[model samples]
Target: MTYLCLGLSICVSIPTYISFMYIRTLRLNTRFIIVRNIVLSVCLRDLMFLFTDFVTSLASKPSYLCEVTGALLQYMSTCAFLWMLCASTDIWLKVHFPYFNHANNIYFYRSLSYISPMFIVCATIGGFRSGYVDENSCWLSITSQSMWVFYSTAIVLIVLISIELAMVACKTTQALKNSVQPANIASTKDPKQSRNMAKSFLPLLAVFGITWILGIFLVIGGTIIFDLLFVIVNGLQGFVLFLSQFLFSKQVHNAWTESKERATTRTL
Candidate 1:
């Protein structure tokens, strides 16, 4: 089951990441930029897990390899979470403030998304010395308190993102209501526009929030039922992401259709 899950995640994630890279229209949007990074990070994380946890376990390997893989996994997972937070915060600011400067602060967001996790992983290794890797697996040692660093960081980021998304939802709802009133209808913007804006953030919020929250629980310990649930939901995250970000995206479909039409026109 674990192997199946990992296989599915890698298969889905690699192709999805490649599609995002090749699709010019997808790259033009700031939101897609953040999402691209998220997908990349998750892809790397799953690959590392497959290698260190499954492959290495089958063979005799040095201890340092496990430690190194543990650190890489930690960094990639944290980076994915941070990117999700950035996405939520970006949408929240845009919804609340019409002129939020996402383009200007994109570099800052990217830096935080990537560098912050590196810093955390480095600090954990430095502070704990030999405590980073567990004896039984290529992951943080729960006994040495190193695992909490990742868990605590994840929990905090999840809470902050949830708050930001909740506020965005409330603000969007209020705006939608205001747009419908007779007196405000003339002055208000289109409710459909507001709804579309809200819809854009929902996939990220639902996928990242629910899966990771369940993942944290599964890691901490859970029943067989919960473990199976986690394996299905959390393991197939890449598939879900592909569905939400690409397959169901009208923009991507339009972009692909237009590109094909242009190619055919040139050929004719």
Candidate 2:
């Protein structure tokens, strides 16, 4: 059942990743970039999961693979989560400070995206694989001291995610106020103004807040229940992780819908 669930997620995620990459070329946006990052993160993490799941899948071999792949799994996930933290921060700042966002749209931020992704991956692979293998895959296996490091990093991600979400909320409130200003009547250019300014990016926001909080709590609490609850949460995390990949396609669908509408109206 576990493998079945995971297989289904990969099935959905593979095409979603391909679709997001295609959409990236056509109609890119911050939301798409964020989603794309998450998809890639999952892609890498799932590869580790597949390798490890094999040990768990068949005869509980508990192979010495964790001594090797363990670092990649941890690093990929940490980088994935950390990059997610960065995305939330970037988007929140962008929403609050449009001018700053315009700066990011130029080139440097684009470069950061590429560079930072690989940096996180390598940093993980290099830093965390000392004495981390026990019987199964557990953080304690990383070593006595590393568990603290893991928790500390988790705390950092939580702090960053929290701050960014707060910033975004504040921006939403200010946007609402600006949106309702007395003189800002709904005129011809208002469509563009409203479309650009509303900037809910609600799906992206939900992905940020929901996934982080849920995963953090799971990681923190996993040592306690450590059995049924932990497994269930991990299962759900897999579901949520893969599920977020689908949102990237919504914008593509929106564009297509609008295009079709325009074509129909023109023909009529």
Which one wins on TM-score? 1
Clashing pairs in 2: 132-141
Give each prediction's root-mean-square deviation over alpha carbons: 3.3, 5.7
Q: Give one digit per residue, the lDDT tens place, for model 1 in 1-268.
A: 7778767878988888787777787776777788788888878887887876664565677788888889989998899889888888777666656554558767988899989888999999998887788857878887788888888898899889878877766766776676553332222265444445447656765766676667677667868877787667666767667777778877778878977888899999
TM-score of 1: 0.87
The Cα error of candidate 2 at residue 59, in Å, is 8.2
Give the residue spans of candidate 2 off by over 4 A. Answer: 24-27, 55-64, 101-130, 138-143, 177-226, 241-252, 258-268
| Runs off by more than 4 Å, candidate 1 | 55-59, 180-204, 215-220
**Model 2 TM-score, 2 decimals:** 0.66
lDDT of each: 0.76, 0.53
- Judge candidate 2 at residue 26 and give its lDDT: 28
For candidate 1, the 10 contiguous residues with the lowest summed lDDT are 179-188
